[model samples]
Target: MAIGDSVKPAAFQYHAPQSVEEAVQLLGMFASDDGRIIAGGQSLIPTMALRMARPSHLIDINGVGELEKLSVSDSVLSIGACIRHAAFHRPVVGNPLGGLLSFVVKHIAHYPIRMRGTFCGSLAHADPSSEWALTAVTLGATMIAESLRGRRELHADEFFVSIMATNLAEDELLVETRFSLLTPGTRFGFYEFSRRAGDYAVAMALVTFELVGGLIADVRVGVGGAEDRPRRLPEAEKVLTGHPPSARLFEDAAAAAAAAVDPMEDQQADAAYRRDLVAVVTRRALERAAA
Candidate 1:
């Protein structure tokens, strides 16, 4: 039977490919057309159990050695899709991005779950509440995708579309991600509000700013869980671009961010509340970055 015909989270064939080429071939053969990539399985497994996602095949890349690399070359950091969130929870020793990643991963979930969650999987899943997505938008990360045809790279802005969605094509496999190194003197801050410590965030904000002399040389503000996808607040950033940091200025900028967003009401939060939370967290994140 064709894979797409199987619904109800029914039994699925599993394939463990030892290399990217093999994985790409398997994806082209069955998984990509109607199969799912099983990397961390932190999100996909639960969805499958609930029958929300009923892919007919599971393509496992756990044994793909090259897909597990973490390295920095020529100022670009490339992280394999299969790396566990736990490995990123602490400073990566030599990589500065490690510090920022560490800050975000801590709020992903508790210890055990983090040990099984993949950074690229979160990127691929494109959860609006995902800290990875927020960071990707804030930092303008790039994603690398491979297929039997060829390879393609997409910027963060191009990759994410909406909640629980991404631009990744069905026959393509996310291999790794590349992040341009932040300039020296850049400061970053993040804040999120969730019902509980590990619950998905209701509203999240993150910022990166660099001060020169007495003025803000550059600043970027982004919010998630307040819209369909992670949103970069260029209007708010504009307010702080060359201005000196102050409480009133930050308030105005944060207000702009809140006003610019269109949030949705769900069981966890109302649209109004999430909007307010976005303002609060945006302000807090800016303040933290400025300090």
Candidate 2:
């Protein structure tokens, strides 16, 4: 076969479901047939083009009107599966979470990719360098999955397993994801390092905390791309809690984060380099949050 023919995706049947129940039913039917769901098609399309993923059936959920819902209620922001990353370009609500999302969303790929990529799709993709995945883990977001079996909720800690993998079952669809709003007085800071402007982050950090009586409280420090999965660094958070926001304290927290992670290494970066980046990004994010 020619190289061009080898790169092309295999023939597959397409199914467009207009409702959540219908989608779940189709998924159940095709679960054993290597069926896959397609949303923004940002990540999957590229893989498909290279013949890395050739599902026998492709389930399209964009036509489902109910899945496009985006709302803030009961102190939580609910993002549907069809909600694009571009949706967060503006503050979706009057809360700090919206602003934080707006700030981070700009770091995802390029303008065209943002217009077509969905927020939940990023989480479902589960790339270690994904900005949205780091944000979701930092905020302790909840993932809602639906299938013919039933509906279930998975916390951020439980949702992500490893690089490009999640707890999502073969027949389950990620219907929605919800994030608890950052309360008043909560400050957020985020920083990432990459080779180029639109490239995936080699290491990134997100920090959120509230100041009580001039001391840090409710601190959350999340590190991504440096490890197999993005996660909260309790060691770093512990270093920050009850401390005043000072350069010394931030550096201490950054050091704690650097020590805590078993950094991932690839052709572009070594383990030592990734760990150093974790320290740098963590400190920068803490500085921004404290600003």
Candidate 3:
């Protein structure tokens, strides 16, 4: 059955392809000012249903065989674009990232949603409040995208452009995401504050640090759900990079994180509230990483 017939209003034509090459060709066929690619129908389906997004053609990639792998290597973890959130919750798949990422994934939206939502789908949707986007950016992950022309790799910093927007082209498909494994002796922490569990986070913080002979060798921190986009706080990282992790250093990092981010006011929180959360969450995350 046609998607228009299945879904009311007949907003557009739909094509489901069985292979990546076929999907790419279908995308090319509908290469116009208003064509969109659909995967998992987790985010795009809802948006289309609301008519918030109206594409002349919907190229469904669910039947494509190339986008469903998750493999780990010596220094990197590679996940295909279509790998579902439930797949990520497996012990083998989720345990390596210090168990912190796994904790966050368990709280994303709901079980039914997680069962259908794909990691790359979440990243491509580019919701700043999304756990996947927030965590990936904090960890300095890489995103691989493919088009009829070719494939390109983008660092997490360059992949997300704004709220609900990304660097992907209309005809391009996100193929995989890669994350560099934290070095040995690296301490890691991930924390987010929300009104209740399983709801969108008000502010989220991720911290990674390397301790070299009891002194800090490197540090990185990222904050999300409190701004227009997920962002790394290099200033905060700089403050703690060489210093030993302590209460004073944690305070300094918290101050730096607060100063670095200019969060927007939303119905859930005000600018001042979000700024305060940045400090609180950053401090807690640093303390946990230090521990």
Best by lDDT: 2
Residue 89 miss distance in model 2 (angstroms): 0.3
| Candidate numbers, best lDDT first, in rank order | 2, 1, 3
Q: lDDT tens digits, residues 15-36, model 3?
A: 8888888877777678665777
Q: Model 2 Cα RMSD, Å? A: 1.5
What are the models' TM-scores? 0.95, 0.98, 0.91
RMSD of each: 3.4, 1.5, 2.8
lDDT of 2 by residue, 157-181 (tens): 9999999999999999999999998
Q: Report residue 263 deviation for candidate 2 (angstroms).
A: 0.7
lDDT of all predictions? 0.87, 0.95, 0.82
Best model number under TM-score? 2
Instruction: Tell me the tens digit of each residue's lDDT in model 1 across 233-255.
Output: 99888888888889999999999
Give per-candidate clash totals. Answer: 1, 0, 0
Write down the lDDT that model 3 would get.
0.82
